[model samples]
Target: MLEMRKDLFADERDDNLNEVGKGSQRQDMPGHVTARTRFFDDHAFDGLLHLKVVRSPHAHARIRSIDIAAAARAPGVKRVLRGADVPVNKNTLLSLINFGKDDEPTLAVSKVCYKGEPVVAIIADTEAQAHAARKLVRVEYEPLKPVFDVEEALKPGAPVVNETYPGNYFEYHERFDHQKLRFGDVDAAFARADQVVEARYQMSPIEHAPTETNGTIAAPEHNDRYVVHSCAQGLFFSLGTTAKILNLESNRLHFIGGTVGGGFGGKVDSLTEPLAVLGAMLTGRPVRYVLDREEEMLTGSPRGAERIYVKDGVMRDGRIVARHIRSYFDAGAYTRLSSYAAIKCTAHIPGPYSIPNVSSDVYVAYTNRCPSTAMRGFGVTAVDFAIEVHMDRVAEAVNMDPMELRILNAYRDGDMKAHRRVAKNTALIECVQVAAEKAGWPLSDTARRQTSVASGGAGERGQIPATVIDQRGQIGRPDTRTGGPTQTLPAGTTRIALSKEPVMEGARDGRAAPTQVPRYEPAPRHEPARAQPPAYAPQPAPPAPSYQPASPPPAPPAPAPSPAHTQHGAVRFSSVFGTRRR
Candidate 1:
């Protein structure tokens, strides 16, 4: 949204204007254009058409029957196609490279897997008509038991979503064994250890909000050629899948790309191209399909939600000896890309710390919800949040500074990760050191900072011998508060006192009160200096525009190609279609 000055002047500026003139030198004028403007204007999508699609709403069901009588009768409706209408072909875009087999359907055949799955398509003269007629097509459904929760789906007695997989475990990489860390000695370490810590953490799944939802336009032409315009991140994947579904040669597919809004890993899969191309083939006209925001959210890929449990063992010397992490992930609907996600989380269990004994396990559970897909940062963020919190607890138990404990166990560039691969770009140690210095390492007030006050008077003003309250009113040794900005509270601050007894006696409420922080006195006025804006001047007006004379068309028609050179003269097809028979 931020516009530069040159962009405003490009449209009206004359190419032959003198450099010495005031108009040419005036950069402050509202009207100016940059070179990029000319480039983009010349290359803009001048003739491309847009498409939209209608979706189903059943979470799990079977299409008992479908009647497109009204849909086909609707005005502007080009074609009403279903899974049965798919052309006979042994080809499927799926290969062994990414999938075990090509199990995806261009349109739902017998059963709809998840809610919002595309079961039928209506191509039309305009997108609005296609959408209107889409509603007119009556589809009878027999709703089945929906497995919404991962744990419920995993139960042995639960109804199976896919009979082929037996239970809803999806697929597991059973061969990949978890790494166990056995450092000094667990029994001896626990015997000599001063403390032990354990914690549980939960993380919510997130979604990738790309600006452009997945869409495509397919048009079939003569001689079996098809052109497809797509917004997918992986063109090769889409190309292969589309060709497979339509039983066309990969080389026969001509693909083009528009400026993408964003991917964030959500648009990496081949989603809607096959259906749109199929519509074009059945209708012999261009068909486009674009998903709306609600469809994008429900059908689009979302990061997986997970639960992690961590147990840690430490010694009186403030060293970590053994640890264990158990993680469970919710792999929604199809197991499309969930295995890779679980692998990533399992691999990064140890994080940046060093432990002699480490044991970890990761499980990918399947549910009837929408399939979980890739998001930014992968699954590492989920594990990191749990591990970091556990680290803090270890530091608290040993009465050691958390930052110092991290530095002692932090991994260096050459240290081996849990995968047994040596880390090459490990910056954990330096990152911690820089962040600690920037935040001011040890504050004496932390010791005196009581989490909760008792009913009686304060215990003997527990203050260290050589510490004093700083200018910001935070008690700490000199230079400890030099890391960054100090905490400052408003003047006349006072602590609020509450009763020692909980408000509700003998109540089984399962809610924890919000954590409150102690206040500090405000610091003196320190206003940062502001920078000045750049100077600008007005531009001079341009001279009267020189009108060019109109050029006349040629009187004679162009000559046609010779028969010998015309190997099946200029016949073209929409690139989205599979292929044409010459």
Candidate 2:
């Protein structure tokens, strides 16, 4: 079964035969199938009441009024719901992942924070009607000048998105010399170094092009709980989040994962599920939401953006004396997983170098772009790119072979990192040596290394191997040659850095689920006061920034006058959908 892998290793014989190591990596298991194959025959999605969300095109705005009356009158339109029709309380994706006591509303109320923020849900008997009705519903939004960049978001004068997180910095945590390892005198070592290399490398945002776009179906399941079918990476997370959003117990949610075409960390986020469930609850009927190709590309969760600056001070003998790296990740809107991403990147900033002195700092700034979360490699990839390329340049400047430089500074068995953790799989030396050998290193100086000869002798037996100038002006392989206006970028492609520090010792330790509420540490200045999740604290007062965009007063609190219309409580599946008759 798919759950067996979570338990003990039962296929040790097969793993040993395959020469693969146990733990963390073992492919042969149940519940594993190619995306194309799984649920290939399941066509139960037809005839469901489809849902459509009306989103805000502006990055930041105050909504004045949402008139869904015309949308309700549209043919095939069952219901058009604004913030008033939503659960009184707000719902957030974070609380859902953590199985928290409460959830943020699936739809925004009063103000929408970022572009593509869901504003209202339009449900109909058919998908076409829901979509058409969505276009008909009119929303009056007061546009506001947005703070798009992270640095601008951090400035004191920047427009604030949420009143809770001030200064546009969503969240912060700093570990000092006490928590971090500080070795030999870093300044003195740099001063005595023969050559020092400093370089800045930047990382751009990337997206996961999942074959299947996000979709969800919420149907009442006879009991009070709802049966939610979707292609989400974390089914438990979805279940918990949906329950919290509806203010129901965990048992009130039954989650079923369809064949996930691809998640790659994207589907881990909450996108269409909340809106679909809410729509179903509002209309007292099943609601289904499906995101098409364009919608997925334009509005799906994207990769986090990063800027990294690294400096290395090395001795004349090619000994790395010290290293320093400063990294910043654009945490769009909410902090999301960017904080954890920053830490992972920073921890690997020093890379596999066995330097005496190393110090690194990482910062995550809130931006008005898509909410950045986990990508394939997270923040580690960004820093890894910066450090490796910096090492390459340091080798060139010192007139030493790049491979030699890496091997010399690379960690050996039982070596300790700057973070005080002992390296378990210190294969840096072997990796460097193996890669150099494969690239045909240590070539004799007298050997004629030819790349390309001539077009006339291309396929002839007695043709001279093509000889061309290498990128570095050395006569070598013409295959490495480039065309006109060749410009080289600073080597900054992010690679795997230091091993990820596991969130907990082992599954048995049972401290907290990796996706559970992350223990937040306050800023250095806010020390002695641990960062607590919003679940424990009262919501902050309304935000009154210095610069106010001309906008209406925030909408009055959502109406909760109708008890039967309440989002949760006494809302059985039967109440949601009357008995279907012929």
Candidate 3:
């Protein structure tokens, strides 16, 4: 049951609404409770065949040879498929939208980039027979040194995880190796700040252990098509991918998906569909390929690990003057969806605050491990955890109340975000205030009086400095060797100085424009500088800046809507028959 906070948004509520604020029963609840729902495995087919795979034992290795003769002769073994059997051996999940190159193979070819990468597939009369035959497939490999750490992978002389991306970092916009977000000069703000706080945070990979592991059952149909019963989270997306990998027209395959035990962003990768369909094609029977418990846990994609570094410049009064973030996403052996995650993470930098000076560099680094895929919240969750914890550290550094600090710097409705988007419909301050009140936490009168709608007050909205707006097109050039920005501000350029009197940029009466902060240059990759204790004594609180509305720059074009958004009701169909293309 959900508790609707009607009191908070009372003005926007409708008096006659029926279901808006009421508790409605879920459509699937009845079937779920009674155990009457039919999952993908529930459907039975005549003469069904079971498929099992032989996986790599080494994290990185050059494949020498595969001997499937013994497996083909094993009892109940009907067919054996190798990497060469796949029509289009290589694919990247996002290639459907022309996002990334086809870097990963359906089955290991000349090399295995990560442990548990499938090398051979065996189809048999029974699941037990398939498992037995899977063991008889012999594969020879010459092991290669593997890199596991994100930073280590980016260093010079590191082992190349993927030949497609030799640099171990995804190239962004074909020019930079990392996604960048630049607003104002963070160095200038840090130079004049009373306290500088910095911290490092790391997040480990997580598995999506759904009740039903990744599985798909493919059977041939009339009209030279295949009907697939799948547990994939996205039906059409999976359909599109399977068609592309098999080099068939989209209409050549029909996908059936519904009653998924759980996905949580895991099943969207089309892990089992292509191979399962190939198995049915090889043998004239229905083939079911499902990951066993151990295989699902070890080989299935997990949420990618992340390493983040956050540095904030704060005043004694709890105002965040500037923030800088550098993060690396451990994308594992290939770019499944990590490249897009990097872009999304970069957009979320400087998190929910009105800090005037902010910059970020987010990298997607590959390592010799199981390739990572999306999970709940995808890119934003790990970084949000890091930013919130870093906020508490910032509060401790300034010796101010954590909740109060957040409220003081919370973005208002009209404030300009570090990404150049105008913040609107924000209510962080109100939410924080309510949370504090519920927790019985004490707050000063000034903190309680803060509102996200209020302007010309303590946390005033900011405008992009004229200087920053002018350099929008040429922000920074990529340093290919290190995957970071190589250039800093031009030599001998004057630094912007903050004045005692506080006034918002583009304010009334043509007042002097706000100070232009200097462009940030990241420290050397080999050695990063650590934050030191504040040397100067605390000074009096700076006067609150007065704000005035300014004409905002034209909004950027809206991003294309995600294909997942168009997904609707379950697809329905029925039949059987099957063939293989060598």
Alpha-carbon local distance difference test for all models: 0.54, 0.58, 0.74
Report the alpha-carbon TM-score of model 3 versus the true structure. 0.81
> Distance from true position, residue 433, model 3, in Å?
1.0
On a 0 to 1 TM-score scale, where does candidate 2 land against the true structure? 0.69
Q: Please identify which of the two predictions, 1 or 3, would achieve the higher lDDT against the true structure.
A: 3
Q: Could you list the CA RMSD of all candidates, in the order they appear?
A: 29.1, 18.1, 15.9
Q: Sort the candidates on lDDT, descending order.
A: 3, 2, 1
Cα distance off (Å), candidate 2, residue 57: 1.2
Over 1-582, each residue of candidate 1 has an lDDT whose tens digit, in order, gives 432334323444555645433435444233334433221112223233333444557777777888889998998877787877755222223231322223345566655657876777777777677778888988888886677766566554654554323345433211111212222234444555567788888877677878677777677756776677777777777776666556556666776663455778676566777777776766666667777788888888678777788878888777786676777677665555565566567667678765554556566665556667667756677888889988888899898888777766665544434443444445465566556656876533433221111211122112111111112111111123134322222222211111111121111121221111111112212312212111011111111011112121111221333334322101111122112233
Tell me which of candidates 1 and 2 scores higher on lDDT: 2
Using TM-score as the measure, the top candidate is 3
For residues 150-234, write the lDDT of model 2, one tens digit per residue.
6566555677655344444433221110011133345556788887788878777777878878788787778777778777887
Report lDDT (Cα) of residue 562, candidate 1. 38
- Candidate 1 lDDT for residue 488: 23
Number of the candidate with higher lDDT, 2 or 3: 3
Global CA lDDT of candidate 2, please?
0.58
